[model samples]
Target: MQMSQLVLKTLREAPSEAKARSHQYLLRAGYIRRLSSGIYSYLPLGLRVLAKVSNIVREELDSCGSQEILLPALHPVEIWERSGRIKKMADVLMKVEAKSGDFVLGPTHEEAVIEAVYQDLSSYSDLPATVYQIQTKFRDEPRSRYGLMRTREFIMADAYSFDSDQEGMRSSYSKVYDAYNKIFAKMEIPFEPVEADSGAIGGDVNHEFMSPAEIGEDYYAKCSSCGYRANIEAATRGSKDADAQGVGSELPELLYHYTPEAPGVEKAVEAISDLGVPTKAHEMLKCLVAIDGDQRLVMLLVPGDREARVPSGMRLLEDPEFERYPYLHKGFIGPMNAKENSIYVVADLSVKERSHFATGGNKAGYHVTGAVLGRDFQVDEYRSLVVVRDGDPCPRCGSALTLIRSVEIGHTFQLGLYYSSILENARFTGPDGQQYPYYMGCYGIGVTRLIAVIAEHFLDDRGLIWPVSVSPYQVVVVPLGAARSKEIEEVAETIYSGLLKDNVEALIDDRKLSPGVSLADCDLIGVPYQVVVGSKSLKEGQVEIKVRRDGTTTKMPIEEVPTRIRELLGRSL
Candidate 1:
């Protein structure tokens, strides 16, 4: 590629909407252009990087016996309805009305893949098959920010595996898991594979590959002592035993007091302090009312310093529900009167060990001191209900946990037989003349988001410093005094042609620009290596090879530049 002919224009400043550092650089570097709030177009430079990542993914998955197949982006609505995901994923589903029938832009290909393969894979003989595709996916994302990190339309490499039994499914899953490790390894980014919750995917076991970054939205907890790591939604902490024998065994009375100005936990703490009680946020009990799946009213209790995690299949009480249950005050609800009001009380494990709590008085403008868990308030259950904090004890080894902010780059799921059992004709005939649902697995990699992740991972104050594996071009040849000095242009063209002949991806800066402008542009473009063909270096019978990552320059013969770049790329790979 020649700089004079390349279709890109670097910007002096990023767009006003661009907030993340990588997002700003991507626009300023002329790699991508924004079309709408959550939509973007990749220029030639960006597309090349995407293609390289996709090729690496293909190589790894193909080596593991997985065949590549492109699935349709438009899927029949009936497929999703049959699988019961139409209602579950209603928020993100992009429905379309066509002349033929109703369809949806596919956010995932599980149902479509099953609809295509169920007939051919009807027997156990055709077991343990994996098929994957690199294609575009659409989702009606509510908050798409950070450029490509969260977009409405993006490229994803999603792979699905099918097997006859549990054992076969495990084998297929491990193969894909190993393939994912290799794929990210080649990308040369720092990432950790942690246990994660299968949110809308509906799976038994899943893992998310998280790349730590300041702009990340997801968080995971890692134990320092035992190496136990999991997503914050799925992470667990150590539990303590109850101080008393059982609920309501002791008669620790509650001392009710008036606190007219205290409506929230923070104000309540202040009011308690005025009464000569120095209480921290964690020293106060926080009560939340929610309705379980069974429509049972339940009160969840946790410390004021922590967030209560609403159990799956349950939702917090909304405004109408609060109006319906007038006795449950918004901020003054407590467990002391839960039994009398026929509301079940669930408390965190830490509450059991605590001797006393300053909590709500079951009335507006009031609080109570000397409220004990087992005595003053009987808990129906003690479970892990709070979000894990930084210093929380690890569930495995009781070590302190470290929370890390990260973005999810990839995910693997052991889907089991959920999808096959729900979807029709997704079963195979066994040797005993009986049919069984196919055990399944899913793996996904964000193809376009990786560009942002790589950009954010390898960057400096000047510009992006991409690794050799996914850099837009491995080498950029810049010639100084191209219009005035014929020797410099000749040397640069020779080096660029030789690099191309050696199968190295190289670009020649043929534009007649100053040395500073040319070198700065090369740095901003993030090519790993720069062959500077200056008049002085050409007169010395040498060309300067500048390493973009470390800013190191070495003078070498023009013929040696291509060989040295190939060596560097090989080592980096």
Candidate 2:
């Protein structure tokens, strides 16, 4: 591609609203232009990059026995309702009304694809098929910022596999996992596969492909020594051996104290200490209120030495069912008052084994000390309810788990029968002649987000250093000051044509620009190899060859330019 003909508008400064490096560089480099807060129009350069990303994804998906197919972006609401996601996804799912009735922009195509497959493909013979699509997806992000990272509309390459049973689902899931690892390696983006919660998209198990970034929304933990990594919500902590201070024989009787104006835990603890009650003799029963349809109590009993917060896996606030449980009082909630089926009490694992501690008095400015679990209050269930902190032991290895923020580029789930059973996407017949819903496995890659993530991982202060496998062009030929000089233009054109003949994708910069402007634009666009033809170098019968990643430049004879560029790109590509 020639720069003169290309719609290339290089910017000296980035937009003020561009918060992320990828966003700024992409906008300035003329790859993408913003249409709205979260919507964008991919220019020629950006479309080329996106095409390369999709091609890589297609190769991997094809290797995993996935047949590519495009599904409708506009889907009927009845399909989503049948899958039980319409109500659950009311917020993020983009709904629109047609001339007849209501519909939704396809966020993910599980419901639409499942219904289609059920209508067309049935029987065990058609079982265990994987269908995928590289298409645009729309989501109504409440606050869309940071470019493609949290876009209201972006491209995604989502694939779903249907299997006869759980065993087949596992087989397909492993294949997809292996393929994803290869794809990321090819993209040259360092990532960790961490266990993740299937939020909104209900499933048995899911794993997120995370790349370390400061601007990431998800908080994942990784053990420094052992290399064990997981999303904080799904990650587990190693068991700590509690102090063997046997339960004291003279355990104090539970008694209520009138505390005035002390509502929070710290103040209540301070009031207890002022009353001369032993801190160890009292368990701190923190009543966490969550609404499910009515006010429900989630009780946490932490040791006096340790503090407690809401656990990650607990569906307290984010759950759609919480809207119904609106009566749960916030801040001033407790476990003592029996509301006759008005509250559901869940206890943390740490609280179940604790001895006596201070608890809410179920009233304003009051507390009860020496309250024991299973004695004063029996919990509905015990859960791994403590938020795993840094320096916490790793569950896999005994090493400490350090929390790290990362962006989720891809995710794979062993969906089991979650979607299949709900949608009744079943197959018929075996030797036993029994029918059952197909087992499912879902795999998704944020095709556009992966591009941003790669840019995040591999860019320098100048601009993006795109990996060869996904770079828009394998090599770029920049003829510095070629607009005025015929010799430099002839040399650049010769090299560019030779590269094209050699099957090397090359961009020829024939624009009327200075050396500095051309070089800066070359670096900003992030092509791996650059062949620079300037008057000074062309006079010496040589061209300057620059490697974008390390700023390594070498002088090559004009005749050798095409061969050297090809050799470098061949090895990397």
Instruction: Please provide, for model 2 over 343-440, each residue's C-alpha lDDT reduced to its tens digit, 9 standing for 90 to 100.
Output: 55666556645566687776656788866554566567665555677887777776888998889999998888777777766454544667777788
Task: Show the lowest summed lDDT stretch of 10 residues, model 2.
Answer: 325-334
Clash count in backbone of candidate 1? 0
- Model 2 off-target regions past 4 Å? 243-247, 260-283, 289-346, 352-354, 378-381, 482-484
Q: How do the predictions measure up, each by TM-score? A: 0.91, 0.90
TM-score of 1: 0.91
Predicted candidate 1, C-alpha RMSD: 2.9
Residues 414-476 of candidate 1 have per-residue lDDT tens digits of: 999879888878899999989999999999999999999999998887788988888889989
lDDT of 2 at 55: 93
| Global CA lDDT computed for model 1 | 0.88
Per-residue lDDT, model 2, residue 107, is: 91
